[model samples]
Structure formats: C-alpha cells, structure tokens
Target: MTLRIRSLLEQVPDRLDQERFETWLETSALRIERILSRGHATPAGEWYDQPRDEWVALLQGAARLAIEGQPEELDLAPGDAVLLPAHCRHRVSWTDPDQVSIWLALHFASDGTPQPGP
Candidate 1:
C-alpha cells in the first residue's frame, strides 16, 4: 500500500505527531517501522542499533531526519527514502506538524539478504 499523509496541527510544540515506533524488526528478520505519528525523539547521545542496515522512506508526509554527527537535514516528502549505512546513528528531528507521517523501514545485511543478519 502507498503511504498517505493528512494535515493536522501537532499536539506538542516540539513534535509533529504522537509517534508510535510500532515495530522494531529488532526481533524480526526484515525490517523496522514507525507507524502513524507526528515524529520520534531518540535520545541525544543514544543510537538505534540494528543487526543490519536500514532503508527508511516517507510514504505519506514530510519529515526532518538528522544523522547524529551529520550537519545535513533531511527533508523527506512522500515517496522519498534514505538508506542508512549499517550502524549509522540517526534520529527523526521533525515531521510536518500539520500532518501524520506514514513511514516504511526496511533492514537487511549487506550481503543482499532480505532479512536481518543471522
């Protein structure tokens, strides 16, 4: 299914929506996911560790994604996607506060495996 976004003011002034990291795939073989949300606030000094690399795409709305040590900001619109180098540290900075974001995340080893590394 295609990701879709809708506009509505976010509840938190610092956040876009009520974020739900609905799935981690941290336990599965293929991917991780952030379902309907305004956005996610990963800790400043912490990083999300997956056994495999990840590819995240904005299926619905716009998002501001930031890699921990990178100075660049990622502005993603619907259909936009990013590939996180394995073990890359990053977090979601903001989402379109006026809309709910639908994201699809996938994780896989560099060896071309469709699922996470064994």
Candidate 2:
C-alpha cells in the first residue's frame, strides 16, 4: 500500500536528462511519467491517428489542441487536462517554442503493466 501511495506522488523531475518517461511498479498497477513534446506549427493542416483514448495536459507553456475536422480549439495551459476518447483525432494548432514542457502521462493497462511506446 505504501508503495502504491508513493507511486501516485508528484514526480521529482530532472529536466536535463530529457528522458521521455519513467515506469514504476505498484500493487496491481503502474505509474509512469508521460511523454511530451514542444510542438511548433508553421502551416497547420489536418494530421491524424486512430482513436486511442488517453489523457494529456500542458505542464508548461500554452497551446491549442484542435480536434481534426472540428472547428473548435482547446486552449491549454499548465494544470489544464483533457481526457480524449480513444478514437479522437486531434492536432496541435500552436505552441510556445521558447520553453520546456513537463507533462505527466498515465496509462492503466488491464494487465497492470506499463505500455512501452516508441
């Protein structure tokens, strides 16, 4: 129980390492540092991927995530969160190129193991 509790605690970051994420084991669960990117869009258009429901937040800076084929834009900043449906197609409309972003991504697999991504 103590271990699981620790897993949910706010992470201590070493931004210099610049690593994408961390995987920590918990009782019947997993904790992971999520992957984030500072996006810069010169000329925006529709780009997309299959629906994979997930959570994303802006840990630093600001940007707009627009659902593909949709007209509304979601303005995001630090501490803001959105739970996108698995089939949602979203694109980054803008971003701050001058700063580093820290994001926490959490994925809970039914088998209680971390999902590794490239």
Candidate 3:
C-alpha cells in the first residue's frame, strides 16, 4: 500500500453557482464527504431526512442550520460540529456569501455499526 496526503481546504473554486459535494471515503458502514457552499440554502419548506445518522463539522467560513421542530437555528463557525440522528430533519439555512464555507460530513448507520447489505 501507499500513502498520500491531501488538504481539505485546497482545490475549491473561487465561485460556485451551486453547492458541491465530494465523497472522500466510503465503506460498507460509513461514508465521509466534503461539502462546499457559498451563500447556499435549502429551498423553503424542504428538509433532509436521512436513513443514516450524520455528523458534520464546519471547517471554514460560517453557516446556519435549521433542524425541524427546533425554535432556533444553529450558527456554526469554523471548528464547530454537530450530529443529526437518523430521520432528524434538517436544512442549511444560511452560508457566508463573500467566502466559501467548507463542511466535513460523516454518514453512518444509526447504531454506529455496519449495516446489512440490501
């Protein structure tokens, strides 16, 4: 086997018309991805409800997240992280317009173990 080093903050474009998602790693039990956003937000009345749990960290810039049934949105800055359990509806409410916002997200089975193949 060989080893390679990569930076998460590199290779991003200066402008983006829409958010970008890149899968960094994937296995039967887990998936890790990098998401780039610039002034992006989920459309009104839309939410993401996933079958697996997701843990996300803010690596650059700033953003706000809204979880269904919550009265207030979450404001995230660099180094902040949050975990959304399976079926927990959520959306990106706001992101910095002047700069790119980088997010690292990990998705896994709800029980934190490998899921049976379908």
Q: TM-score for each prediction?
A: 0.65, 0.55, 0.92
Q: Model 1, stretches more than 4 Å misplaced?
A: 1-17, 23-28, 32-34, 112-118
- Computed on alpha carbons, the lDDT of every model, listed in order, comes to 0.68, 0.57, 0.95
Q: Tens-digit lDDT track for model 2 on 6-88?
A: 53324534343332445543333434454444545424666545334456666776777788767788888888887655456
| Model 3 deviation from the true structure expressed as Cα RMSD, one decimal place | 5.0
Ranking by lDDT: 3, 1, 2
Q: Once model 3 is optimally superposed onto the true structure by TM-score, how far is the C-alpha of residue 49 displaced, in angstroms?
A: 0.2
lDDT tens digits, residues 1-118, model 1? Answer: 9977633322213444357655544654576665565645555666676567888878777788778778898888998888887778777777766667787787767775455432
Best by TM-score: 3
Model 3: residue 114 alpha-carbon error in angstroms: 16
> Over the full model, what C-alpha lDDT does candidate 2 score relative to the true structure?
0.57
Output the number of the lDDT-best candidate. Answer: 3
Error of 2 at 101 (Å): 2.0
- The full ranking of all candidates by TM-score, starting with the best, is 3, 1, 2
